[model samples]
Target chain A: MNKFREGGWHILLLLICLVLLLPVVFMISNSFKTLQDSYHSMLQIIPLHPTFSNYTTLGRQIDLLRLIWNTFFMAAIVTLGKLITGLFAAYAFKYFSFKGKKWIYLIFVSTIFVPFTVIMIPNYLVISKINLLNTAPGVALPQMCDATGIMLFLKAMDKIPKSLIESLKIDGISSHMILKDIIIPILRPSIISIGAIFFINSWNEYVWPTLILKDKSSFTLPLALQNYISSEGGTNFPLAMALSTIMIIVPLFIYLIFQRYILNSISNSGLK
Target chain B: MNSSGSKNKFLTIAYLSPTAVILLVFMVIPILYTLYLSFFDWNLISPTKNFVGLENYTSIFTDSVNRKVLLNTIVYILLLLILNFIIPYFISLIVKFFINKMKNSYKIIFFIPSLFSLVVGAMLFSWIMNPISGPVAFLMRHFGVALPNWTNSSAMAIVMLCLITNWKVFGYNFVLLLTGLGSIPQNIIDATKIDSIPRWKMVRDIVLPLNKSIAFYVLILTIVQGLQYVFTPISVITQGGPYYGSSNIFYHTYLNAFVLYKTGNASALAVITFLVFLILLYLEMKFVEGRMGNCE
Candidate 1:
């Protein structure tokens, strides 16, 4: 009876996972299929005959490597920039006991609630006005700072006992030395956690890039993907799936590798 | 103390300048510029501008198309509230208390869809749910069931798009709620064991009360983020199509400015959107627990 109860829940949970993961499985599975095969063979979870021809189609239509590189470059630059800037800001936020600190923090945090729609037109105009449209830096620049990282690092810094920083302060240590020697090492895990989130976010960002990047060469993976679809619609499903699989693979791998950190980052958000 | 205080102030500005500059340049200025643009008519390409004054705002109400788009926006909010908020809230509870083995596996699996770009999601679902050649349609036919072309009908089209957003967001929302549930102290549950309160009752009484702050936070996030998430699917799959049936506020604003070159109208709509969410943010600030939205 006890084994039955245990087995029952396991089966149910696995069954649920299978259902939820079907789109992903369907994607990876169908990507291996031929165009004609994709249309007819709905039942085949695995392709009856797999081939790389569909994958090759992606190569012919677009600069697949360049697309991947563009997205990767943007994500990397934005994530690194966010970390450095957020670190300094969060550190300043914690160190200061100014008269207007409360109002200042509120202004920083209020950026989160400014819906992207409100700023889309003006940002686009600003970028184009400055002749930054169709550039990777243009796409990455606006996303380089976020309050989430500032808040995460600030909270983590708060948990660092004040006495530790104070004891060092009596030695008249420069803020630079204290930050380099103490804060960076203590906040390493949190930096990784927040970094994973920022990286994945920039990787998947679609809308801003759509407005900013105009050249085919500058297009990120997601933008290139839609470009492929609009031009080659209904001509090939397997090819489309292959492109999607390619676009998804990196983020999926990152999430799997850093699953703990990503999950921990999110969980930490709601708790505090 | 005076010199040190001035030194501290200088360093504070130095440390804060990187973030402050980006936000001011990208965020603050944009809001103000959008507000300024809302009052004038400009094609964006041409140098000429026409002062429309309040015509854009007035037409948003008087115009039938804008009214329908607003209605569609309301529908999007309602459907998204169900898909991303209300439903995930309940599911998180079940996952937390029941069938708890391999919990991490469940979390990982659920969060996978969220990891993919919304563009990829749009492509995958459009392929999978294609009425003619999609696998789902093909599978349904074998069972003597005919699949409806939900994409053609504006109402069903919106529902389909919402479901697309649900796939990507539900897991993210679930993880947030489950993490919130985990924050409830262990002793409360242990104390309840003496009374042998039914699981549902324990959840209703003890769990729900303690989870209020995080729940409110998730609720506000679903309304705000959920609208943005649905935008990609609408543009990719529907293009707010079948005669603007599926277009919401965000998509409509995009369409007006970029697609139709109606910058003033788009700017006006954008201002309205900012105000609407600003009120929601105000409510969240006033009511939600200070800490839940902190460290966000």
Candidate 2:
């Protein structure tokens, strides 16, 4: 009886996994199909008449390469900014005994609870006032101060032995030198893990970029894809799928490469 | 010694300034500004602003459609809390039980959906759930069953929105719960085994208690992040359509601000939403604090 139950359990698990993966499979398979093939043969997992027309058309219609570059550039800058600022703040909180340190930490962490919707309109106003709208830096700057990243770095920094820092200080090492030589090496994995998260998140960001970026040439892949979808209005299914495929490829690649680090960081930190 | 102490303080300020400044300028000030903007009637482009004292708030309460939007927002959040956090939680346990050897592979596979941009996921699902020529319709035809236009029908739109959002988010929560499960000390598991405690009882008595903190964290995240999660699907797929059927307060606010350019109304909605979530956050923190104190 136990054996039978175990067998049933395995089958159920497999079925669940399949259900989770089916949409992804559907997406990739259909991206290669012709427009008629996609519409007419919706149930087919593998395209009967596969073609590259969807992709070629996508490239011609929109600046696919530029969209890709814009996304990569924005994500990189945001990740870099978050890492630097997060490290500095985490270092201060972890290493120093300053007045109002606890209060400052609380304030920073509380920003996590403030949903972006609350600040959306005002932030837009600020951006537009400064004339940073439609620019890459504008899209990246507001989101760079990541509370979760600071908290993650702070936790990681807390684990570093205080004695080691003291010894480095005795050697007349500056705090910056100590951080460069000691703490960073120890926290490299966590940093990379957190960086992957920052990259993926900023790359996948839609609403903020949509709000900030007005020019078509400046549009990130997500906003561009959303625009294409709304503009096309389901008239061209295959091309939309193709564009969706292109938009996801880089992030999917990043995720696959850093899957271990990403999972490790998420498990270690309490971040979702 | 005093000089070194002052220098240390200077360094601390220098190191902390970037984060502090950004938070103050972008986060803190914006929230304050949003509150201030809630009372005004402004189109965001016009040079003139009119003060409409308490009118936006009054309409939010009195306007029937706005009331329904609020109700829909609450319903969406409740559905997400149950489907996104609660269900995946139990599923995570079962998955943990089954996938002992291939855990990493299974995790990656499940998380694939989450890796896709929400816009991309929304677009992809818009096709899959397309009523006329999409796979869902085709499959329904094959099975001799009718699959309603998932995104268009008022009745099914919100439920379908919930399901799609759950699809994108379930793996992340599952992994989180799995981490919670993994933290269950082996010694306790061994003790439970030696006692021959029934499996379900072991889970209840030993596992559930220890996992309470992480579970609470997930629950809180679900509630706090619920609006952002539903925004994508509502925008890309449903457009909160079939006569505002699937529109939550967040999307409603977005439409008011960006699409309709009613900046004042949108800001008012945002302020109200913030207050509501603030209360939710307080309750969650209080609950978790009490539970954690007991656990320790």
Best by lDDT: 1
Candidate 2 segments whose C-alpha is farther than 4 A from its true place = A231-233, B97-99, B289-296
Among these predicted structures, which one has the highest TM-score? 1
Q: Give per-residue CA lDDT, model 2, range A79-165, as digits (tens).
A: 999999999888888877887776677678768768777998888888999999999999998888567777788767766888888
Q: Positional deviation of B291 in candidate 1, in angstroms?
A: 2.7
Evaluated on the second chain alone, the candidates' TM-scores are 0.96, 0.92
lDDT of each: 0.84, 0.81
Q: Output candidate 2 Cα RMSD.
A: 2.5
DockQ of each: 0.63, 0.57
Give the 10-residue window scoring lowest on summed lDDT in candidate 1 chain B: B287-296
User: Candidate 2, clashing residue pairs?
Assistant: none
Best of the candidates, DockQ? 1
Give TM-scores for every candidate, taking all chains together and pairing residue i with residue i: 0.96, 0.95
